[model samples]
Target: MTTILEAKHVNKSYTVHQHEEHQILKDINLLLKQGEFVTIMGPSGSGKSTLLYNISGMDQVSEGSVYFAGEKISALSEKKLSKLRLNKMGFIFQHSHLLKNLNLLDNVLLSAYLAKNSSKEVIGARALRLMKQMGVDGLASHNITQASGGQLQRISICRALINNPDILFGDEPTGALNSSTTAEIMDILHDINAAGTTILLVTHDVRVAARSQRVLFMLDGKLVAERNMGKYNKQQNIRAREAALSDWLTEQGF
Candidate 1:
């Protein structure tokens, strides 16, 4: 696989109050290869979401740079960054973020429409195909309010795929779903990754993290440990992973 996403010495900080600073990400580094699925696991307030936001160009970093397909996204103007995000990356959030006024198909196609590079006809066809793969094809015309939470979530995934992004960044994609629905979403994500799309998922769920080929364990806004899941069975790997995590937490006296 080729390198698709790379971040070097990335740092981000937030201003909490007058002359007070909160360091959310501290000299972070990351590299993602094509067709690889990597999950980031961290406790609350550990900067998992902040890392995702910075890497995905949703927010500017305080320092360092992120390279996507040989382009430095950190240097792009806001307009160009928006284009890069819309055309090259797919995002699935905890909430589906679908428009209430539009049906499933319309919601998906609307992204392409706003991006200004793809045709509605092409986007609509691709969106339908993705929804069909997710088993939500029968509800293409249904509004989000009319759909079940699981259906809406699947539709969000389909929307993300409509543009055939170079990478998929999911921030707790399964966080709001029941176990069964979460499992379904996980299976879908696995299938999508198997089909050669690079994926970066930030999740607190152990089961979700175990599904990835690599797990990056973060603490206090830093990547303190990493586990290669390719070396062990899923159950054993998760147990070991959790054990290591426990050790880290215990060391911190938490």
Candidate 2:
């Protein structure tokens, strides 16, 4: 498999009050192969989200480097980085982050519009297709405030995939949903991964992590351990996978 994303000796720190420096990520190294699904799990403030941000270029690493599609992204100018993110990568956060002024379909089409890689007609058609695939096509004309949390999340997924990004970075994508809704979202994500989009998610839910092919455990700003569960098969027992992952996480002192 091809390596789509990599982090090498990455470190992230922030200056505190202009006097002290606090480290958020410590010497993190990782490689995400094409079409793989990986999850990061850790306690709050353990730097899992920080690592995601640094590796995705949403935040810059204070040291070392991040490479996307074999290019050194950490050294790129902000304009170039923005273009790369717009064209090559996708993001889904805990919140939908949809604009209040735009309808759901318009919101999903926003990034595609900015990318300008396709005509409005082409992007519109793709956006509608994504919305239908996510089961939110009926809500296309609705405002963000009109949808439930789960529905909004599905819309966000549509927005993320509008550009057909090579990789999808999710920060607690299902954190706010109920168990049933979380399962629905995870199923959609699993299908997306199966369709060949690499995914890296930061999550606290064991259910979410169990669905991933690999899970990374973080502690005190360091990557402490990793568990490979292999690819998910629909015929396999999900409960067993979740139990095994829970046991490993416990052993890691999570």
Candidate 3:
């Protein structure tokens, strides 16, 4: 598989009170392949989330570089990087962050409208299709407060896909949902990946990481280890996969 994103000897730090350096990511290297589903897992303050933001260009690196689709994103100007992200990347977070004023469907169409690459008729039709694909078409006209957590996340996913991003970056996307709801969301994500979106997620849940094709373990601002668990499908024994991953994570001091 071709490399969709790569971090070469990356390092990141911040200046604390009185010029003290707070190092977050340290000499890390990583990659996400085309059409792959990868997750980063670690304890609190392990730099997993920081790494995600840096590699995706949501934040800049203090040292080294990040490449996305062969472009050196770390070196791009803010304007160019914003344009690149708007055109090629999608993001989801622990919170849905949907606007309070817009209807669900309109919320999903907000970014597409900003991009202004298509007619309203075309974008609206695609919005409805994406909402339906996420099983949220019934709530298209409804306010965000009217839906469950899972439904809101689905709407967020629809919004993320609106511009047909080359890669989807998720930061603990299923963190706020219950187990059953999380499972449902994971199923939706798997189907999306099968349809060809490269996904790189940061998560702590073993069950969530188990569904991914590869899992990267981070510790103390470093990429410590990884596992290639293979493709996921309905017929496979998920519990067994989870158990095996759990054991391996334990070995990683997870």
Candidate 4:
């Protein structure tokens, strides 16, 4: 498989008052293969999100390097990095983070408009297709307040896929949803991964992690364990996978 992203000896630290350093992420190494679905799980303050940010180039590593598409992204300038993120990567946060003033369709089209790699007509068509695939096409002109939490998240997924990104980075994407809604979102994400968009997600829910092909456990800023669950199939027994993962996580002291 092709390596789409790689982190080498990555470390991140923050300087508190009086120049005292607070190390957040320890020496981390990881590689994300193309079209793989991977999840990261850990207790709060375990630096799970920090590792996601560093590898996605949303935050700079204090030491070591990150590479995307075989290029050293950690060494790139902010402008170039921003462009790379816009064109090559996609992000879905816990919150929808939609603009209150814009309707759902416009919000989905926002990033594609900024990217400018294609005409408005082309991008709009693609955005509409994604919204349809996500089952939010009917809510196109609706205000943000009018949609349910699940619908808003589906809209956000539409926005993330508007650029046809090589990889999707999700930070607790379903964290705000109810169990049923989380399952729905996970189904959509599973379909997306099956359709060949690489996904890296940070999640605490074992149900969510079970849908992924691999799960990495973090502890005190270090990756302590990983479980390869293999490809997810709707026809298979999901509860068994979740139970197995729960057992392994227990072994890892999670």
For model 2, what is the C-alpha lDDT against the true structure? Answer: 0.96
Error of 2 at 163 (Å): 0.2
Off by over 4 Å in 3: none
Q: What is the C-alpha lDDT of each candidate?
A: 0.85, 0.96, 0.94, 0.95
Can you write out model 3's per-residue Cα lDDT over 1-254, one digit (the tens) per residue? 89999999999999999899999999999988899999999999999889999999999999999999999999999999998898799999999999999999999999999888899999999999999888999999999999999999999999999999999999999999999999999998898899899999999899999999999999999999999999898789999999999999999988
| Ranking of all predicted structures according to lDDT, beginning with the best and ending with the worst | 2, 4, 3, 1
* TM-score of candidate 1 to 2 decimals: 0.91
Cα displacement (angstroms), candidate 3, residue 16, comes to 0.6
How close to the true structure is residue 45 of candidate 1, measured as C-alpha lDDT? 90
Instruction: Output the TM-score of candidate 2.
Output: 0.99
TM-score computed on alpha carbons, candidate 3: 0.98
Candidate 4 lDDT tens digits, 49-124: 9999999999999999999999999999999999999988999999999999999999999999999999988998
TM-score of each: 0.91, 0.99, 0.98, 0.99
Off by over 4 Å in 1: 231-254
lDDT (0-100) at residue 211 of candidate 3?
93
